[model samples]
Target: MRTGGGTGAGAALVYGTGLAQGLALVCFPAASSILTAPTGYDLSPSRYGLMFAPQVVLAITAAALTPVLARRWTLQRVLVAGLVANLLAMVLLVLSQAPAPSGGAYLLLLAATGALGFGFGSCVSALNTFAAALVPGREDRSVLTLNVLLGLGTALAPMLIAVLLPRWWLLPVGVCVGLVLAIAVAWRVRLDPGPAAGPTAGTPKAVLPGRFWWYAAAVVLYGITETLFGNWSSLYLSGQRGLGVATASAALAAFWACVTVGRVIVAVLPARIPATAVYLLLPVLIVGANVAVSGASTAATAVLAYAAAGLACSAMLPLSISFAGREFPRLGATSAGELIAGYQIGYGVAAFGVAPLMAATGLALSGVYLVGAAVAAVLAAVAAVITRSGRRPDPSVPATPPVTTATRSDVPERP
Candidate 1:
């Protein structure tokens, strides 16, 4: 399974982008306090929530177009393009700091989020493809590793924002520098992301098989579940639970830290434990974690609950992308993009969707979390269906020989 120097370099660059993307992606949400503070951006709950509306729209569009763009432009070029967009997002965030919290500042924030959405969509899709193709037989572990780094970035976001409090713009500025370096390296290094390259790039296949909808449905649900925590946990803790801003930020950091830790645990789990089992089990945990968070009153209790939710959410996205790649060999790297689009759809539903419900019904976030538990239940049902059948390995990637040892991943074929 040795890779050439170029492939290894490409893989490093791709994985690094995952971390950078994670940081940039969470910057806005992680600074939720500042955005909504009366003296800060002066954004209301609805306006703050609505900021991501454009992000969801553009992210889905960019993700959906990844395959088409890869076909026409090549995966390396697409990755670089995504990085450029990511840089623009950071730049916009920095510029938004220049204006006072007026319509002008708010509009800039909206634009920044929209750019972030597009960058996230394109960058994550391409990174997933490269991660799988670069590692061949180890696609599952590779994807998990990539996402572990992503989770690490997410974990760092809240803490970093807290540390650099009045200097929030510095975070995005730092991200811009990292992205610039990644783009430079990626632009020069040639990456052959298996079938997405010239060989089958021109091949016209069904845009997506009907079966993809199963993975899509699972991830969309997952998106809703994760966003409930990722986007709103800080606000929920600070506003509803009556915690200090710094304490709430710590709780958010704890949640994402546990996410990274959980992903690491999943990656190293004994091979006998089936991935599908882990996948199915996570949503069920998410269901329970939601209930725990909803009921938590004290800082310690809320932090612990958030940590549990993070662990529950840790591996769903990576597993979804990995399973989709295994199931649709012909689609190659593009399969990740389609799955990402589905996830963004869920993100949209939860991101902008919950705000209106609260504004219209005067419901509290605690109640919203209760509704999330129900969503996670449905997600578990979808996971059951997705994992019911064994994976069909990708033909392009060389399959590892079946291991003889009893491993953590082993499970009965039927539930």
Candidate 2:
């Protein structure tokens, strides 16, 4: 495990882990219909949302502790631990389906989600670090490639559910096998993610730079906007628009498919577009898509609107992490970990708060999309400020890698 670099087998495993993680992360959300249907878990809206509360709490804790744990446990050990947690989560989810809807079943689901939170927190943070190091100078593209795999897994989940229906537990069973494979690979590969951060990175007294807070805030807001679609799109379509379960599932899949395809397009686009430009423009698209989705009537319109929302979400998170990585090169894994924590905060807010807000305000799911549009607008404003700042890479390090065939035009604006 202490003998390999971040290429060849190790890189493939890292990317595969991303796909597996995507599948694991979306399992609960993808089964939202089944979990709440009369024939299924028979949960109320608030209860459905409340299921994620423990996940949020534990995920934040695991993610925020990555840098601290990495100092002693090493990134490899931390990743292995995350994988084991993920496996336990999938196993519990499968067991949860054995009993009919009852307190025992619900408790199993809660325990599974809590484990998933820890797994997602630690696993994703480490993967971001490894992905950034894969291509040396091309951190953004590398991360985008990894996320493409992740988005593909997410897209596949609901489609599988649409096909499998009541047998959705099989999906996590497959993911369990995948996790087992990933854990084996983690054990075999060292996955050196360049160099570790400076000594202060692990110190209890140390803090991230003030400028990093803007990126954190932007991601937190972005997380809320993303979850509004990821967690609620199916419910909105089936319940509000009178679409069938299959149609709603297809719409959700469409959103994730576009997210994958959009990242691919951005990664290989010929134009030397500034990353900041993409970052700022996406939130505007999100705003429009959210408004459109809220008013959609037909299934076609709902699917298309959600697809647009997915495209808007495609590259934003990777870009944010990459940007912060470039600005503060020495922070290494800590930067990604902290940003993940921020995004999970937003995730928690949207996951639990939406139902309560709807109940208190007497607004429908459509109105929630409208509110998400406002949040996207705020995200746009934050992106504008980040772009204007235009922080350059560290002066002590070389501006470009000494390796291969990438020309000046292939790279995005560094900041």
Compare the candidates by lDDT and give the number of the best one: 2
**What digit string (tens of lDDT, one per residue) describes model 1 on residues 1-415?**
2332237677778789999999998898888878989878889987988888888998999998888888778766778888998899899888887685889988888888888888998999988878776654566787798999988988788778878989877899899999999987886677757643322456674366666788889999999998898778767988988887766776778888999999999989877678878988999999999999999889899889999998999999998887777666557657888889999999888877887889898989999999999999999998887788645443443553332223323321100
Best by TM-score: 2
- Candidate 2 residue 256 Cα shift, in angstroms, is 1.3
Which residue segments of model 1 deviate by more than 4 Å? 1-6, 195-201, 359-363, 392-415
* Cα-based lDDT for every prediction: 0.81, 0.82
- 23 in model 2: Cα distance from truth in Å? 0.9
Which portions of model 2 show Cα errors greater than 4 Å?
A: 196-206, 393-415
Whole-model alpha-carbon lDDT for candidate 1: 0.81
Give every collision pair in model 2: none
- Cα deviation of 377, candidate 1, in Å: 1.3
Model 1 steric clash total: 11
